[model samples]
Target: MARSAKAVPWFLFAAGGTVIAFILPVMIFITGIAPAIGLFGDALSYETMHAFVGNWLIKLILLGIIVLAAWHAAHRLRVCAHDFGIRADGAVSIVVYGLAAIASAATVVALLMI
Candidate 1:
């Protein structure tokens, strides 16, 4: 039997879901809620964030999170479209995955430029 091309995207979707489930809420708290509530006390300020992103490791982590999240969202959207009786799986797959690919590329480029 021919190897399934579906494996990679499925893997990414699962991994992305795990990443989003585990990390996203903490990120929201750190970047959104904690800062607003003065929990970090200037530790999360603009200059601090700029310096944080200046690190290669941090950049890689951010790239992974953003790209995976994009792919996860894309796959979920595609599945939802099917469930809603969109019926055009081919076109839906192309559009959703294309957007995910574009998002992944953009994330890499943006991180590298940082």
Candidate 2:
């Protein structure tokens, strides 16, 4: 009965992909487009937005989104490389996952500092 450790990254990738596909666009529109089109007014103002992000719950959600998305992209890249005839999966995994780890760490630090 061997356990497959690969399930962990695959899980993150799937969850991240789902979030990015479903939520990211709405987020982008709210944050980017709505403001530009004057739809949100002060909802996206600096003070209000800062306050929203400063909440612990919001911080956690943002952290999850950022980290999971990074992991998702990394795993996708690794798969694409494999599909393209790249054979060094171990090295590719280390590189891409390492970058994701770095990005996740940076996201945490940035969120904490905000």
Candidate 3:
């Protein structure tokens, strides 16, 4: 059997979808809802969050979430474009995946800067 280069993007797409479905909501709750409800009592405050993100492991997790989410979004958009009668799969894939790559690189730089 011949090797298929499509596996990498597909893997990223699946992993990203999983992360979005599973982790994104909890993140929204922790960063948005929980604080509003005062559940953690300043646990999610700026200082606390800054300190939390300062950890290398936390940074890695954050990076994964961001990169995966970006890739997932890009792949979704590409498919949506095709579904919408856009026959230019090559161009669409290039634009969408390029944006994902840029987003991933930016995320890495941003996380590293932290």
Candidate 4:
């Protein structure tokens, strides 16, 4: 049996969607709602947040989140473009996935730098 390359992107899309679903709301609450409504707490303070992000595991998790999110977004955009009567699947796939790859690489570099 032959394996289709689509399985890779589909897997990424599914995983990314799952992660985003769980994390996006929490992020919005912390970064947006909490700060705006004065619910921001000491746990999210500069030093605390810095230390949290300073952990290697935290960096890896963040990198995974960012990369998966980008890949998921790319897949969604590709599907949306197809639905919009754009028949350029090859080009769209290349551009979208390429952007995701670039984003992933940049994330790795940034995380390492930090």
Per-residue error at 79 for model 2, in Å? 0.3
Put down candidate 1 lDDT per residue, 18-58, tens digits, no spaces: 99999999999999999899996989999999899999999
- lDDT measured at residue 62 in model 4 versus the true structure, 0 to 100: 90
Instruction: Choose 1 or 3, whichever is better by lDDT.
Output: 3
Per-residue lDDT, model 1, residue 14, is 99
Q: Can you rank all candidates by lDDT, best first?
A: 2, 3, 1, 4
Give the Cα lDDT of each candidate.
0.92, 0.94, 0.93, 0.90
Model 2 segments beyond 4 Å from truth?
1-3
| Candidate 1: pairs in clash | none
Between candidates 1 and 4, the lDDT winner: 1
Q: How well is each residue in 14-91 modelled by candidate 2, as lDDT tens digits? A: 999998998889989988899999996787998999999999999999999889889999999999999999999999
**Predicted structure 3, TM vs. truth:** 0.91
lDDT digits (tens) for residues 17-82 of candidate 4: 998899967877886788677675676777887788889999998988899999999999999999
lDDT of 3 at 14: 97
Poorest lDDT segment (10 consecutive residues) of candidate 1: 3-12
Looking at candidate 4, the ten consecutive residues that score lowest on lDDT are 35-44
